[model samples]
Target: MTDCLFCRIIAGELPSKQRHSSDLVIAIEDIAPQAPLHLLILPREHIGSAADLRDTPAHAALLARMHAVAAELANEAGYGDRGWRLVSNVGVEG
Candidate 1:
């Protein structure tokens, strides 16, 4: 996991334009944003992707928290009323 880009960012080994941070997740501004407000919400835990999460109560709770944090960030960034997109890229092609 030392080679994981996000893990390095979460560990403060890499510099990121961080917007929000909490015990569960951290939101960082996208380096190459496709939209006016593009933020990448990352869990502190080193999960490969959403597909990596098992169907368990703990994973469910973590997913919920991630969504809540996204919503909060969108609202704070003035995109709540206009809405925004949440995306996850999977695999190498993604």
Candidate 2:
């Protein structure tokens, strides 16, 4: 996982690090944003893929925190309750 792009970003080894990084997650604008408010909300901890996510309390908390950050971002962007989409890409196809 040392070679993972996200891991490097989280480790402060990459310049792509955004202003929204925290202990639990890093929220960056998508390099190729397809929407007006596109953002890539990634975990600071390196999880190999969505398939690698396990059903545990820690995992659940992390996931919840991710979504909460996203919602907060959306609301701050003036999209509160207006509807926004979150897309998750898993495995190779991502």
Candidate 3:
């Protein structure tokens, strides 16, 4: 996992436009945003991709926390009322 980009960012070894950070997740602005407000919410611990997170309770908790952080950020950014999209890429196609 030492080679994982997100892991390095969470470890403070890489520079990122960090919006929020906690023991569960780290939310950072997308480097090449496709939208006006694009953020990448990632788990502190690397798990490869969404497919890696079977159906475990811990993974479910992490995902829930990620969504909560995204919603909070969207609200803070003035997109809560208008709404926003949440996208996740999985596997090699991503």
- Give me the candidate number with maximum TM-score: 3
lDDT of 3: 0.93
By lDDT, the candidates rank as 3, 1, 2
lDDT of 2 by residue, 1-94 (tens): 4889877777767767364766799898877879999988999887888889999999998999899999989898888879998888988888
Q: Against the hidden reference, what TM-scores do the models get?
A: 0.93, 0.89, 0.94
lDDT tens readout by residue for model 3, 1-94: 4999888899889999999989999899999999999999999888998988978899999999999999999999999999999999998897
lDDT against the true structure, per candidate, is: 0.90, 0.84, 0.93
The residue-level lDDT of candidate 3 at 83 comes to 90
The alpha-carbon deviation from the true structure for residue 54 of candidate 1, after best TM-score superposition, in angstroms, is: 0.8
Off by over 4 Å in 3: none
Runs with alpha carbons beyond 4 Å of true place in candidate 2? 17-19
Give the higher-TM-score candidate: 1 or 2. 1
- The alpha-carbon RMSD values of the candidates against the true structure, listed in the order shown, are 1.2, 1.7, 1.1
Question: How much is the lDDT of residue 18 in candidate 3?
Answer: 94
Model 1 per-residue lDDT tens digits across residues 28-66: 999999999999999999999777889899888878988
Model 3, residue pairs in steric clash: none
Cα displacement (angstroms), candidate 1, residue 74, comes to 0.6
Alpha carbon lDDT at 71, candidate 3: 96
| Better TM-score candidate (1, 3) | 3
